[model samples]
Target: MKIDIVSVFPEYFDVLNLSLFGKAQAKGLIEVHAHNLRDWTHDVHHSVDDTPVGGGAGMVMKPAVWAECLDELLGLEPADATPDAAVDTATDTAAGKPVLIFPNPSAPLFTQRDATELSHADHLLFGCGRYEGYDARIPAYYRAQGVNVREYSIGDYVLNGGEVATSVMLEAITRLIPGFMGNPESIVEESYTGEGALLEHRQYTKPAQWRGLNVPDVLLSGDHGKVDRFRRDEALTRTNDIRPDLIEQLGCKALDKADRKTLMALGWEVSGEHPRRRGK
Candidate 1:
């Protein structure tokens, strides 16, 4: 996969040079590039933002610099073209549009599932905004051209710019790519990948009898059959206590008859409790 990020503070991405992502890049499993948004500017100051047209607290990113940068990066003609020339170039751009977008608060909430879907794309473009925000026309222009434009948030809070948020998202998606890790099995068995409908249960180490608190005998016994059953039951028990929502989403299939009975003992109805009966 190829990802191109357009941000004013491209230097922030220097963190990517020494991590799991860096190792992945060394193996050529993916390519990641962060371009300075001001590189397309022609002026002495090389400014990228301006005061908003309407009275506002913060400045807005200018359209000219964005147009120049996007055109050069994507192989479109210069911004000074006449109407016919603009139309011709736009027609060509319609043939190859970017598949991803990072928008403001109005878009859908991002999720692990969304990251999984985006990891399969051939190309993804991240538009990072600073100060007040991007020129409103930018999103409209992309949408008119039939590109897949979407806005996503890391959480309910706001950040200084989208670069940090983009980084968070990029890391999530990159880790899911097939050859990005040394052991592919690690991805399937880790917490929250849904091999089981719960977080990774408690893990114990070499001191089987630390402080006289013994490790479960099944694990030390080397009986894989018994170990599997113990781990699943423990995971289900932990989920029922901490994240009951997961238990609710998990059908009866997630819990055997014994596990269901355990949950019921904890005052958690496995299924089919009427709304009123499920007390406050």
Candidate 2:
């Protein structure tokens, strides 16, 4: 995959050169490039922002700088032309296509599911607005040109720019790539992969016994089948106790006959009380 980031703070992307991302690049699985938006600015000060047209609280990024940077890097005209439109017209389509995204606090929340979807892209491009925000017209411009433009949010909190959010998104998606992890099974067995629930119970290496605790016997029984069953059972119990909402979301799937009986024994009911459990 190829990822191009246009940002005022291009230096912040040095984080990609050190870890798993670096390894991916070295292995020729991916290529990441960060371009300074100011490099495309024509002014003496290399200015990329201007006073808001409507008199906003902070400066807004100019469309000119973004257009020039993206156009030059993507080999397209900077005059409101969409990346996709440009690619379709060109003969060289070796690098499939790219996605245009800008992270903002007002956008829909980002999640692991989003990462999973983005991992399939041939290339991804980002425009990071650092001052107040980008000129709103760019999003509409891309949309009119048939580009898949989107706004993403990391969480409820705000950041100075989309740089950190890009890092978060990149790491999450890269980890999902095949052969990226030391143990592939770790991805499936992990929490929120299959069951959409938190991780199953865990018992770690020890002296068999800790300060005042002991590893569950099932874990040490040396029976693979029993160990798997024990882990699933514990996961059910833990999730039900601490995050019942998740169990509620799972509905009937959250409980089998044996688990339902067990819940009944613990004063739970499908209809009697515990309104949360009643409908499920």
Candidate 3:
């Protein structure tokens, strides 16, 4: 997949060159490009923002620069296309038209589900807003022109800019693309992925016995069946304690007789009230 990120602090994206993403790029499994938002500016100051309309506390990004940049990137005619240009159904775009991405706290929370889904896109264009954010009309104008636009938020808290969130989201999205990782099965059991309804099981390394702490005995037993059972139990226990919300979302049916028994043993509330477990 190809992803283009437009941000005032393009340097913030330099970290994308590290580790797996770097390797993925080397292997041509994915492509990423960072563009400076200021390049669209025509004035000497290269200012991207001004006072927000309606008297806001923070500055709002200027619409003209955004429109010019996006128009050029999306293949809209520079002469005819402007932020205030009339919306139309024309589909012309540079190469594979990217699905536009805007991160906003007001938008739906981004999830592993969304990441997995976006990994399939042929191209993606991420708009990283600083200050107050991009002019509201930018996305609205694009959407009116038949562009596919999606908005997502990482969490409830706000940040100085969208670069960090975009970086995180890019990692999540890219790793899911086939061939991005050497081991195809590596992501199969990742938490929030398919069939991984519970939190990921705790991982361990060498030094079977460190100080007074010892690795789980089952892990050393080489008994694949027993090891699998142990891992499942740990995952279930962790999820039940740390994120019961995920368990609740899985609902009663997700807990079969074995899972219920494990939870019961862990002192979780799975007694007569949860009658469905009795038949499982």
Q: Report the lDDT tens digits of candidate 3 across residue range 135-220.
A: 88887878766677777899999988899899989989898888888898988777877743778899988899999899988899
Per-residue C-alpha lDDT of model 2 across residues 185-270, encoded as one tens digit per residue: 87776655554455567758978998999899888999998887778777767777786665555544545676566555544564
**After aligning candidate 2 to the native by TM-score, how far in Å is the CA of 183 from where it should be?**
1.9
The most accurate candidate by TM-score is 3
Clashing pairs in 3: none
| Separate clash counts for every candidate | 1, 0, 0
lDDT scores in order:
0.73, 0.74, 0.80
In model 1, which regions exceed 4 Å deviation? 75-97, 103-106, 195-197, 204-221, 253-255, 272-277
Give the lDDT of residue 170 in candidate 1: 88
Candidate 3, TM-score vs. the true structure? 0.86
Worst 10 contiguous positions by lDDT, candidate 3: 86-95
The alpha-carbon deviation from the true structure for residue 59 of candidate 3, after best TM-score superposition, in angstroms, is 0.7
TM-score of each: 0.78, 0.80, 0.86
Over the stretch 1-280, how does candidate 1's per-residue lDDT look in tens digits? 7778899899998888777899988888878889998888889998999999978799999988887777665555543323232223223322444564665655577777677777776677888888888898775565554455667888887788999889888888888889887787877645556533576678889889999799988899888978887887777678767877666666555557777766666666656531111454
Sort the candidates on lDDT, descending order. 3, 2, 1
**Once superposed on the true structure, which residue ranges of model 2 sit more than 4 Å away at CA?**
78-95, 195-203, 207-214, 237-245, 251-276
Question: Of models 1 and 2, which has the larger TM-score?
Answer: 2
Pairs in steric clash, model 1: 103-151
